[model samples]
Target: MTMLEGVTTRPGGRRPGATRTRVDILAAAQRSFAEHGYVLTTIRGVARAAGVDPALVLQFFGSKDGLFDAALRDDPPVRALVTLAGEGDPSDLGPRLAARYLELWEDPHTGPRMLAVVRAATAAPSASAMVTAFMTDEVMLPLARAIGADQAELRAALTGAYLFGVASARYVLGVAPLAALDREAAVTYVAPVVQHHLTGDLTPP
Candidate 1:
């Protein structure tokens, strides 16, 4: 089965209109946050987009913040990343991690959610905290400790910084050349840096 298959599902066989309305509001909120950004997107705007009352948006999500959190909460990439760290050979972790990271972003099913978090995090403190906490607790530290790296936390932090820089430049900023490169080519260029961070000695040679 596809890695992103279980992240979300179609609202099977048409349930109650209230249930469907909640789903519609959530979908609209995601699109609004992705397109207009968190600050500019409002509950009223989402309600208008979803063809529901602003009160209905609050009825389902409590607040705009709550809706935003719900929209981004089902991140499949994190699960995939943890699994990759656990299942792969230590020596190949850097390259494999880089490849998988790009794969998740490039995929249609997962890419928007990835971008939404990355983009929204820049403009919203709460989003930034959520991303940072996830990276530290769920990804970087775990991977570093799993591989028995020295200064594991530092290595993890640097790794996250490096990966996020690449992602931001290529995917978010639309930087020339980097953004234009194919996924494999980008991985080849960046993987060694990741490998060095993952396994190479950090001390001066």
Candidate 2:
């Protein structure tokens, strides 16, 4: 018998078609979450966007929270931030990190996903906890430790707060001159503050 004749597909097997369908659903979910945030996005809406039955979406991800968790974990900009935290000279880490963080927000492809995560964190407790854990445990803590900073956790937290505040003001709230500033000028203003948070002394006078 030919090789193909001897092989039979088993029931419930993970075929290529099933994998493609899953991927399509995930892409739809990402877009939905990005456009609508966690509180507003729904399994049925994502299913409709993917052109699949709502049951299939539920089958793949179990629940709306599960899908949101997956989307957060799969986010490229977050991954990029984590990767950046480990690279380059500690002295210049501030500007590099600042530039990259801003670039992700500016890029049309990644901007929506980043905006979704931030907005969802503000709107939903579950999303907030997940994002807080990821940012602190995965990205900031390691970077602080890698730089041999004392009070690493506190340093990491401060750095995160500064960056988050900047992003929220400029992108989310569209506040004043900050929102209007060009990328380079914003970076120039932000880099030093980030540098101090990461490496400067924190002891009170």
The most accurate candidate by lDDT is: 2
Candidate 2 ranges with C-alpha deviation above 4 Å: 1-21
lDDT of 1 by residue, 1-205 (tens): 5222233323334335987878777877777776677788898888777777788789888987788877766453655676766786888888899999988889886787778778878988887877777777678888888888899988888998899889999999989999999999999998999989988989977
- TM-scores vs. true structure, each candidate: 0.74, 0.83
| Candidate 2 clash figure, as a count | 0
Cα deviation of 69 in candidate 2 (Å)? Answer: 1.3
| Clashing residue pairs, backbone N/CA/C < 3 A, model 1 | none
TM-score of predicted model 1? 0.74
Lowest-sum lDDT 10-residue window in model 2:
1-10
TM-score (C-alpha) between model 2 and the true structure: 0.83
Q: How many angstroms is residue 17 displaced in model 1 relative to the true structure, after the best TM-score fit?
A: 12
Steric clashes per prediction: 0, 0
Residue 28 CA error for candidate 2 (Å)? 1.1
Q: Give the per-residue lDDT digits (tens) of candidate 2, residues 62-137.
A: 9988888777776457567756656777888899989988998999888888898899889989889888877887
